[model samples]
Target: MEAPHSIISIISSLLHIYILVLVIRVVLDLVAVFARSWRPTGPVLLLANLVYSLTDPPLRFLRRRIPALTLGSFGIDLSFLALWFGIVIVQYLLAILSGLL
Candidate 1:
């Protein structure tokens, strides 16, 4: 049987990867918003969609509970940043629990 700390360490690593992905997703969103004419072609769009599909479920769940920041018609989706912070904290805790910190 594997050690429990080892399992926590593995989970923490996965969460770190997810946090990185979320960062990339945020950059993509910003680019899309600011660059009105910019569009992703073939493979990039496919990967973006794939990332969106993976990340959206968690974001939607968070959005329902978390209020967004808005200025008139434009609003910032706070859930993604919230989740990013949350995962960071969780990962930190996991690192401690796993005795890797």
Candidate 2:
């Protein structure tokens, strides 16, 4: 039988990769927003669009249900941050549980 720790390690690693992808998507979106004058096209825009499509569905759904929190002129989108942190917390909990087992 496969050891529980090994299985948990595998799962955690997979989650870590997923988190990294999510972070990259967020960073790319921010960059695109700030660099709108540059006009990325062809493959670069295609890649960004693909990543946005993949990342936006869940965030849009959550955002519709949750109200945005405002701080003066800027409002924070907690839904995306919540999802990201939730994944991290889940990974940490899994690691801890796996260690205990």
Candidate 3:
């Protein structure tokens, strides 16, 4: 029905926004590390908190089940990559369903 198509469209839009937020989270994290000041303050702090709250739950869920890959001194968090792929897959499925209806 048209209702289902509209719902899927909304969800697809939200997923796109979520993907952008996830990218910001990754960039902010790298910035924090390179800046040598892990504790952000004022507006930066607020933004950091907002990003963390939005992205942490799903990441934490995957993180708890899967550990990061450590190569010497460097470590890679697979959860972010996994979450990104998962979202893409869901978006693809939604697109297919939308096309069908």
lDDT of 3 by residue, 1-101 (tens): 78998999999999999999999998998987898757778998898899999999999999999899999999999999999999999999999999999
Candidate 2 Cα deviation (angstroms), residue 73: 3.4
Q: What is the TM-score of each candidate against the true structure?
A: 0.83, 0.77, 0.90
**Model 2, backbone clash pairs (residues 3+ apart or across chains), number:** 0
- Top candidate (TM-score): 3
Runs in model 2 lying further than 4 Å from the true structure: 1-3
Prediction RMSDs, each to the true structure:
2.4, 2.3, 1.4
List runs of model 1 lying over 4 Å from the truth. 71-74
Better of 2 and 3 by TM-score: 3
Candidate 2 C-alpha lDDT tens digits along 23-87: 87877868768988766589978877776777788889889988899999999888888778878
Enumerate clash totals for all models, in the order shown: 0, 0, 0
